[model samples]
Target: MEVDATALAGLQSEVSQLADLFKRRLFEDRSKNALIESVQDQVRAVNDLLRYREFEGLFKEALLAIDRLQSESSTPELVDSVVDELLEVFRRRDLVAVDDSGIFDPRVHEAIGTVPASADLRPNTIAAVHRTGYVLGDRLLRPAQVTVVVSVDD
Candidate 1:
């Protein structure tokens, strides 16, 4: 039996409406998924910032303790114990001390002052370390404060 023209047109209209509805729904789903991912990324960033703040506080405390120990005339045993405790805290936080080998590196060391270069010590070499620097997993957390040797003529 032949289908009625009016009936066929009505069926086509319904199919078109259904297809449009499906497309709209798919678009909405994708937008919702993108919004969810953005929120997740923001949350992760906030958590990372909080962790960094906590680590900063702990590091400052350890530095202060070490400074006090150095300023005061303490027994060798007490100084050793204090140093060990500071090191333990750093180790737990994955912080490594920057080596002070009289070698000056601008990347990890901050030259606070300059000293006269001697015959044995070359210019630009680290003469003294005023404050120790630290690194976290190949990333510098803080630059070491140091005094560098400068040529007497310069």
Candidate 2:
């Protein structure tokens, strides 16, 4: 009994491809796990913030103000708990953006529109955020859509 050389070479090629596929799958799995962990950490932060009683009071009152907001028909207390935590997050200013630079980058700032301001004052600076932003590990959890002011050279 003897093995053919061509058959062995073909077998080796197949094995190599399989090995590469396994490696890629493993890397993807690890990358997805990291993303999941990062998201979980952010969720935990909100949960911790919501645990305060005062925050809960304010959150409930605000929700009650909603005209068409559904107050959770699925879980009895789940909606209340989650809303309190999320509202607490907003109330505490958990979402923030700080830039000493007088210029706004489109990547970091989603400019809804530009405003007119003095060159000595508002040189392309971030005026205000239309919506709040979130941060995670030095990465933007959400980009702040803000209005920036540009100084026109007269």
Candidate 3:
């Protein structure tokens, strides 16, 4: 079977037009996808800023309490009151103080130093705490700075 020259040329032209159409559609789809991704990123950035502003507003009172403690005239009672106020702010923001128990957990504790193990203190246990830590829900905001007890090497 032999295809006519005119018919063959017409088929080739039709195929070329189809190819060009496909290329144009592919480019348009890609452009549309890129624009959509850009919009989504912008929205996510806005949401993050809004969340930061909300947390900042919640800590305003805690900041004021801290400022009061900075004054030289602050007494022990005033210090205690300021501490309580700060804790209240943390609670309002769903933040909790990390528990620094005798047992040291690497997930929430940062070892600052080590002391020799004693009869009362077991190895790898917390001997002292230098700083307190906090957590926001399930996320760790800070690790407790603690001294761990190490076994005495002979």
Taking all chains together, each candidate's TM-score versus the true structure is 0.59, 0.36, 0.72
**Top-lDDT candidate index:** 3
The full ranking of all candidates by TM-score, starting with the best, is 3, 1, 2
Evaluate residue 116 in candidate 1 and report its C-alpha lDDT on the 0 to 100 scale.
90
- Which candidate comes out best when scored by TM-score? 3
Per-residue lDDT of candidate 3, residues 1-154 (tens digit): 9989999999999999999999999999999999999999999999999998987877788779878888657788998888898888888888898888878899999999999998998999989999998999899999999999999989
Candidate 2 C-alpha lDDT tens digits along 93-123: 4444534244787666678877788644566
Task: Tell me the TM-score of model 3.
Answer: 0.72
- In model 2, the Cα lDDT at residue 137 comes to 44
CA deviation > 4 Å runs, candidate 3:
1-3, 67-72, 119-124, 151-154
Model 3 weakest 10-residue run by lDDT: 66-75
RMSD of each: 6.7, 13.8, 3.3
Clashes of each: 0, 0, 0
Ranking by lDDT: 3, 1, 2
